[model samples]
Target: MNFLTDELDYEECDKEINKNDINYFRNIWLAYDDFWHKNKYDKSKYKYVKTAPRSPNTKYGKINDFYRRCYLILETNEYYYPLDNYIKIKKRKRTLTNLEHIIIKNSGNGKRQSDVQDIVKNAKFSKTYMTNVMKNAVIGVEKIKEKKILLPNEKLFVNMDDCFISSLFNNKKQKNRIRTISANKGTDLEKSTKSRNVLKDKKITYMKTKNGERIKRQELIDKIYDFLDLQFIYNKSSLVFIGDGAPWIKTSAKKENIPYVIDRHHAFKALKKGFIFNRKVDNKKLTNAYNLFINGKYYLLLDFLKVNNIDEKIYKYFKNNKEGIINQKENWNQGVCAESDVSHLVKSLKGYGAKIYNDKVLNNLLLINSARINKLNLLL
Candidate 1:
């Protein structure tokens, strides 16, 4: 049994006590100390002996008035009961400190719950407790984000893309699901290519849904629209939706009556794929065709592709996404880096051969990752 206080240093106090009626005072003090020690360590003295609450009552009712024995654990692994009475009847409930919640939450970042258990030592939290802590932390951070008002910018660039990770379900079959990420800011391609830190400044939100289900996909789109609506409420800023010309993305923008811009990188990649087999079109002609597209000469570019016997699928791709094509000579759509953002945002979930078994855990992980990316303080 560890006592909360150190024993008295009798030798150090001997000189002071020697001056007056030493034997009489010493005997009295020794008797009192023995009685106090016996009372403190006697198990029968305290009726409620539990160190902490196993399951605290969270609901508001008359039952909550019952007394609960609990102890507080500090960051240094030191714990103590705030109340001296061990068996008093009261309504107190046991809960983790803010710092404890934060430590558990941060330790689990980019890590599995079991991994978090290993990282956090001397804590009474189990894997289930850690999961609940993370879930609650995410909910708290989300509430904070909801109250935040993004400052209006002259132009608000929106980028949306889907990232997929291996599903834990049917592992033998290796199924996949969609985790969509959307941001209010677009990365400058030139700068982003020079340094990856440019993405750190963007505010991102993520959604998880089934890969191919139409209803789920529509729900995701509606959620994204709601996010956008909230962000756009404070500003009359010009909005531009940038993506890789995915059908869902196009549909999302069209439904919202927003302008959509096909990423230039995807556009050029499509052109190269289309012309890969055409040996007749030399490098010079390829460069000329690229220039025609960049210069917004869509009709001439189509004629050039046809004359060069480019693949018809590429022609149709460009024809269908013609409106999304950013004209360097006219529009200022510098393209989007959605693919890279997806890889960066969901790296933890996709890395270390990680697999998510349920939507609840997956959504919690996504929210935690997004909160970390946005540099929101989960400790609050």
Candidate 2:
């Protein structure tokens, strides 16, 4: 309490100290002291007072003596009659692996199954765990039908994506969060959170590694379309989704029947590229950037600038290309939430590089955005 209100609380305490008419300080001081030191204690802190640990026993006690006697008998190769009659524990107890962890995590199954292993592995666990993990990831599709996470009428305007993590086994394998592989990482979801939105409680829909490049664009669109049907919303004094102008993003809006705006990243890139091209540069690259933007080859926009050269200030580069920026105004406005959404995705799954054995696990990781949204919105 002193730390929070500083010494001021102490002064307040002293003001009421001594006389019973004035009020005793013990209750006031103890409560305040406890409040400030809540975290310094454990449990929920400040709400419930944790009992101080019970004093250790000075006597050996009955249970302790019983255990010692049993140990002595076992050491002497003498099995007690009652001890022998105690049922033995089973052999080969199944421990869940990383893949199993994901399957269970993703297993809501519209409440048909509470057992994770049931829907995930059909109740079998083995090396085939990796293969079935893929089957479970596909269960994410079923998950969308009745989102256990997203509240009714909640909209997911974001896209989820991840690169097929490249493998270390001669760089042949690709890892997803639920599916681990060879890639190290740049995947921390919060690391992906830019400094600007730091204080905001913004975990709207976004993709983590789902944007990476491993999952196909068509697959994303199909999932969105199918999920949107499950989420069929009739009105919007209640919900809205935001995302950038990725092609798949626009297509998802059409499929979901939910209103959305394409986020500004694509347009922003075009603006940056335009300035780079206008400024003096080698001829071949200049033509390529212009052609790429004009052709809606948006992904190429950033790479084009990088591969050619970018000596100008990023702001100036955008300013010089202001005309290019204007061209994307509608898209920029529509996709404004792209920054918030996708960046969050990157933050949550950033450090995890575990191999995903299947689609079920992959989709489980992708659902974090929805899970977070539901968690926050629980207040409403």
Candidate 3:
């Protein structure tokens, strides 16, 4: 123990002490000590401890014997076993090629799945087979969902966003078929706990599916609650969701009794584009639209669009989300970046010319990529 703790000096020690080592000498002393005290030492106890070697060795040799004893103890689950009867368990065998290891490593590095097959050398397997193996490796690992609050009294800032997957190999006939991809990421209200800063350990979840039917607003709400429940992340009083001012999101927030805010980025982008698209004479309509949107007078803006013979789609959308948009106060810190999360986690599956529809495979890969990004055990 002294040597292990760097408290021992080698040169000053006697030759006899260096050869037999302290552990060996201590064991012999212990045996004699026990026999003298009890008049009959337990022989079984010595079986668990190493028998002194025929030839004396240095401390390193004694250390090996110590490790061997530890392994036996672990294998037998702390039960007494004869030294000769200890079994050495064989490791699970595998013959992974260079290509297989490379593929798995690439996925862990955020490489595109379609591009992974290109890195395989010798071309021993078909492209589809290689792709399947890579996907399977990802799916074989357990799903991960964990959260950590880094600071005391820190609130949870949650954000949700949506994307679409437009291509599926088997659904070629449906040219416009798209799967809705919804994602959510969260962090503590502590300034240092931003998503980018905590990329390796952020809270994230995803749900993507296509059934040709409009997803009910309640379904999305239920999913949000389910995700939080599965990850064991819940604190309604200290939780707030940031969304893109979608009617469904707002409605769901109301139902769940949680506060939500309009994403400033998306809101400003829509206001600018809609103002340009709905231009009026002398920039009159454009200026009014801008003023109303910035001031959160979405209902008045919709009326102005209607009276001026303009399509009310843009203003109507703003009106439906008036509660969230109007409640977006100046002090509210908005750091939800669900869109980028999709780009990082689902980029490979949704790459150009890549067709995917199997929710099982996509969901599995999503979990694996999420785990890898957070520096968790990929196989877990």
Candidate 4:
């Protein structure tokens, strides 16, 4: 009974002559006005449109398009690695990537194809194509495979760390993906006390897999190199790399032939472990000895009498032995550059109490650093 299979030869949907039909339409609309207002909104859709029995064709279309969109996300994101071309979608040149769009639309309120057809009764494209676009407009992993991952220049003062995440971990509340994090360090005394999600648009040098279980170490390096190649296409001196003196970073330094700075924070970490952590040294002696060495007054350290000085006195240390002077002079000034670096950068950031990298943590770092570097001209 609901079937209007044949094309309409009737007059237009006008109110003047077909007053009865118009009244009937009004009654139907009034019955469900609030329903459409609450759901995925389409202001133009009239309530006169009744929910008819589901059609096999409509169901088939929904199922097919859903699968197609899923395919688009899978195929496009993967296949379209290093996307060198601009995307024109629905008359807009957009950065809304294929996968991003798919994820965005499906995640929000939108019209279903079946209900839409009842209101419009006509369409710009075939029902199939429209359904396909709406259902699976998201780009796929395949497209991503074809896309070239972009790499921005090695911006200076860029914070760097690596992380692992997976849902398989036992932390039910946390393991939306289980993850571990580490900074670039020569001797990684401890993993980073930071979050995995904190670097999304920050650092401008890396990305995480949506799967959350995957990691990116060397991949970040490769992507950065590729990005550098592109920048070299424009200007040769756009960026620089900054991280602690880890072996991997040092290797990347050689490979990319980029300048490297041992992050001042990590430099202080070495001092904390070596000089600061030593139990044999007392604070007074250590401080005075260091000051003496800094002033190039290694011998005056005994006048400041301390544990090492006491040890020297027990052996008639001042009279019989004097290797301490030579030892302090050789090392104290030699590594001052590294220690001075720590005093500057580490103290500047107050690089302590690092936290786990969650969305909030990552966003803060990314946003703050971005504003500082690109706008304030604060961080290079």
For candidate 4, lDDT tens digit of each residue in 127-221?
44433343333221111112213235322222343433322223232322212111111211254245421221221223434444444547657
Candidate 3 least-lDDT 10 residues: 84-93
Quantify all predictions' global Cα lDDT against the true fold: 0.54, 0.36, 0.49, 0.31
Which number leads on lDDT? Answer: 1
**Could you estimate the TM-score for every candidate?**
0.59, 0.33, 0.55, 0.30
Report residue 339 deviation for candidate 3 (angstroms): 2.5
- Supply the TM-score for candidate 4: 0.30
By lDDT, rank the candidates, best first.
1, 3, 2, 4
Prediction 2 global C-alpha lDDT: 0.36
lDDT of 1 by residue, 164-268 (tens): 764443333333455455554444445666545363236677665556645455686777657666444435345667787788777877776777777667778
Off by over 4 Å in 2: 1-172, 175-222, 235-262, 273-335, 353-370, 373-380
Candidate 3 per-residue lDDT over residues 298-322, each given as its tens digit: 5776676666655367666666777
Model 2 lowest lDDT segment of ten:
54-63
In Å, residue 15's CA in model 2 sits off its true spot by: 35
Root-mean-square deviation of candidate 1: 12.6
CA RMSD of each candidate after superposition: 12.6, 18.1, 12.8, 18.6
Q: Which stretches of candidate 1 lie over 4 Å from their true place?
A: 1-139, 145-153, 169-176, 179-181, 185-193, 196-201, 215-221, 229-237, 277-287, 326-329, 355-360
Clashing pairs in 1: none
**Cα miss at 10, model 3 (Å)?**
36
